[model samples]
Target: MSTPQLLMIEDDARLAQMVGEYLTQSGFGFHHALDGASGLEMLQQRSPDLVILDLMLPDTDGLEVCRRIRAMPSNALAKVSVLMLTAKGDPMDRIIGLEIGADDYLPKPFEPRELLARIRAVLRRRGEGGSDAAPAAVMRFGTLEIDRNARTVTVGGMAADLTSYQFDLLVAMAERAGRVLTRDQIMEAVRGRELEAFDRSIDVHMGRIRAAIEVDAKNPKRILTVRGVGYVFAKQQD
Candidate 1:
């Protein structure tokens, strides 16, 4: 397997340098851009496996950058994983980042080890299309089809756009269709970590998925909300 490449879009030169060095030593190909424009340019040019984006940039907002990334014309680039870095106590920024398609977030003033772990976790989930024990390469439910080997989803033979993180969440829920899963259960199913009590990132991703797969996101038919609980992937999807 090729070494995973990472691009960090951060304005703090000293912090970017330290992170670059640390990630480099940890066996990753690391690159840095001082601002969002340069970062987006580098993203198109290098096509890194994942982006480590700082929430605050001098030129463009990190959330906007994430939105633009998700809107890219090329499917490969649009689906690239993004892990955002936000300031401490800025929970709203983190939530906004996720709402706009960021895969994960780590707060500022974090240990390099923790950052490394988060990076690995995001990449791991992206690559885990399905395990050997998985039943089939493609899972179908009515008009919705999930191709594990291709890492793609289609509804009524039309492609469904989904970020890597969102795709994994969909797969997790689809695999356990008919079960009512709580937020924590869904998070643990995807990444082996319990959901943080206050974190609504999973719900954000689910909304994105429903928008992509459901004909009408406002009244989703594929993934249903089990009011007062969590959600369920309808075994009988239309």
Candidate 2:
């Protein structure tokens, strides 16, 4: 495939300039917009493969922009993956970003290499369409159907619109239904990445997955939270 296209919507002009130079060397077709409005307009014009969105924009919040992208009519634009950047201290920013459909997030004041790794991982997870991974058995939990081969999910015969990350997360838990897997274990199953001391994006991603599959996200039955242990998929479905 061609060099993956990327659009960075950030208000930090100095940071944007520095990132632009790095991305050019890293083999990406890159563009930058200083605000959310221009970013949305150029999103249609570019149809990029991935977006590096800053959580704090001058005109609007990045979460809102992410919502708009997912709501866009064009299949290419709507499904385009997003990577959010935010301050390191505010944990809520990361959670909110995922809740609104961001594919991944990296905290601010991060190394360039870390950002590149996140960008590549998010793009690979979204772009592969399950081609690179080995096929797994399809999972059926009563009215919920998970086709690992097709990377699709259906609840009560209705399709669940899940992002690539959410789908992988659901599949991970479903594969071990009835067994609670800690956040580290879940991350390992999905990405094979080493666990960090305080990586809470798992919960945020789980919330998004519940919203997509559960009959009532506010009171979920499919994926049960084990309080401090983590989450478990129901072995017996209604």
Q: Assess each prediction's global lDDT (C-alpha) against the native.
A: 0.87, 0.85
Off by over 4 Å in 2: 129-137, 192-199
Model 1 residue runs over 4 Å out of place are 128-136, 192-194
Clashes per candidate (backbone, < 3 Å):
0, 0
lDDT of 2 by residue, 98-168 (tens): 88888888878978888777877777666542237647667888999998877789999898888778888
Model 2 TM-score is 0.88
Candidate 2 collision pairs: none
Q: Show the colliding residue pairs in model 1.
A: none
What's the C-alpha lDDT at position 170 in model 2? 90
TM-score of each: 0.93, 0.88
lDDT of 1 by residue, 118-142 (tens): 8888887777322343345899998
- How does candidate 2 score on lDDT? 0.85
